[model samples]
Target: MRLYWKVVLINGAVLAVATLLLVLGPFSVSRHPVVSEAVVLGVGLLVMLVTNSLLLRSSFKPIEKVVAEYDAMFERLEDERAASSARALAAQEAERHRIARELHDDVGQQLTVVLLGLKQLEQRVPPELADELAALRESTRDGLDDVRRVVRRLRPGVLEDLGLPNALASLANDFAEHSSASVRRVVTPGLPPLSPEAELVVYRVAQEALTNAARHAHADGVELSLTRVGDRVALVVADDGRGFDTRTDGDGLRGMRERARLAHGELAVTSSPAGTTVRLEVPSS
Candidate 1:
């Protein structure tokens, strides 16, 4: 029962016992009672108070035990969930690395050979074919560079070698090279060191967001930021362009959310007539 009800019950019982004794006992000899009504009532109240205090004290142990068990169980479950997520992220990263290696060693090498063959043919072919061969050569170069860039961004070797700052600079430079707008990256120092998984998540999300801004958003400029807020790290990518409605979930948006979720973080995209902003927060704890 609730403590208030228990107190009431105990007080009632004490009052009943006191009243019964007072009425059942003989009357006082000098027209006064031996156990006065005030005395009986006061003693009953005191007894009720003491008994209630003891009852409450006894109840505390069980409550604490239940709370402690709940906390322990919740903690264990959380650890399991976090571990599962980490494994999934590791698997994804491994696959990305494998694909990048295959592109660099297998497909990339073959493309280089084909370009060499085309150059050799251009030298031997007729003078009338010269213009066509030149066009083909130029096209091949652009296509190969584009493919390398896309593959590199999908899985950047620079990120593994030079860390996030250098990787972001390279990534931004690549984007700016391909587009008219200048892409700026500001990586604040003194930020907490992120695990490899967290770094990948941030980088991938920024990459996609920048690509979207340059290709579709028609933004003249974009800013990418990486910083720490208290015990949490934050990544913000903003663009000054015709903003998009965030409620719509395109492939890029879905990819961004998956990256955040893989890193055990939260993502939010806010866009309006002014601009678009993608914010990510990942807590160390």
Candidate 2:
């Protein structure tokens, strides 16, 4: 039965017992002619009072325990989520470092050399073709902007300077601006800050989850949760979309789990006929 009903039933039983004692007091007292009726009635009432109090206390005790269990579960889930998210952030940061290294050694250097060659050609080109040359230069400038955008995504400037919260917020905002989907971002405050590695993991995990939801799941809604406990954190992303089969493994799921392992955490993917939930947990400082 429901908790409230059970409590009410317990209270009803207590009242019934008390009422029965009051109703039977006259007959029991009548049998005792030597004793005063008032004495018998007083003793019966005292017994009823004690019985009611004891039963009511017992009922409330179980309810208290139930509530405590719920609170404990919430805390554990939060811890796991935070740890998972931290892992994502760290992975993303590593990816950024790799991208930066490549860009600096390859693309950036090549682009610089190309720009120098264009400068030299500008001086030697025929006067009649100046218009076409200028257009070419403009095209090169546009390409440069595109490359810069890539670098920014690979190594989010905000990440190193502004920290995780701002970096996450910026990511959501930029993604929303660039994509057509309406993102529902839920970030709770007062969570203990994660380590740089932890932050990167969290971000990457979220990034993948959102991407899956948008690209594969065709989900209309996504939820991101970040919660903190004394020594752990949790990150959870749930989507209301076409769910996947748990029996089959995919790159997205494997990558997410790998990132979690990198952060000393774990990843769980729960999918049903109705929807899907990706949960991650990691430790916090």
Candidate 3:
């Protein structure tokens, strides 16, 4: 039966029992009652109160059970979703690694060969054409450099070759070199170990936060820190610049959040005119 109908029926039954007692039972209230009549009335009222409490409890039991079942169902669905996201992120990182390898081994080598050929050709060319050939050589060198940069971004060999600490240190140095901002990095000593996936997530989030600070925030100073918090490791990137609206989720912020979710971590972003901070916390192994 519908809950509303069950409630109505229960209330109706209670009212009927009360009416029956008033009409057919021995209890009665006079304009001025003696102690014995008052006692009898009090007893009847107590009986009615107990009966109503019992009925309400019985009627609501099923509802409470249903609510508990729904809560469990939702929890299971959330776990499944998180697992799926983690799998997808793993696949994405694998694909990126493959592409970076191909570019570095194939395209990068081909560009190097072309650059060498240009260098040889420049020596053989006439004096009139030397300037143009030199320009072409320079252009090829630039292209090769660009390719290497892309490969680095796609694979982050530093992260694999070194640990998370060195990877973050390299990132901070890169940011400082490319932007006007000064960066300070602090990694707590003897930190708890983190899983590979968690490390990558933290690295990516810090990278994105620093990129945003350099490109968009126009910050002059930034701080990147990794510390152990309880059983979890926390990565924080804070910049002293014009902050953005936290209500808006840009692509960078969304990507960070997705990465954090896959790692079973929590991400928080706070922004104001004074500065912006992106914080990510993940469990340690």
Report each candidate's C-alpha RMSD, comma-separated, in the order given.
7.7, 13.7, 3.3
Query: What order do you get sorting by lDDT, best first?
Result: 3, 1, 2
Weakest 10 consecutive residues of candidate 1 by summed lDDT: 26-35
lDDT of 3 by residue, 1-285 (tens): 887888788878988988897899876788999999988878777887888889888989998999999999999998788678777878999999999999999999999999999898887889999999899889999999999999998988888889999999999999989999999999998889999888889999999999999999999999999999999999999999999998888989878988999788999999999999999999998
lDDT of 2 by residue, 10-67 (tens): 7788778767866865445455455566776677677767876787777678778988
Off by over 4 Å in 2: 1-130, 178-180
Q: Which candidate leads in lDDT?
A: 3
**Per-model TM against the reference:** 0.55, 0.56, 0.81
Q: Which has the better TM-score: candidate 2, or candidate 3?
A: 3
Task: Please give the TM-score that candidate 2 achieves against the real structure.
Answer: 0.56
lDDT of 3 at 13: 90
Assess each prediction's global lDDT (C-alpha) against the native: 0.80, 0.75, 0.91
Model 3: CA > 4 A from native: 31-49, 126-129, 178-180, 215-220, 229-232, 240-254, 266-275
lDDT of 1 by residue, 30-146 (tens): 355456755765665687678656766675667788899999999989877766755776788788788888887887888788788899998799999999988888887877887
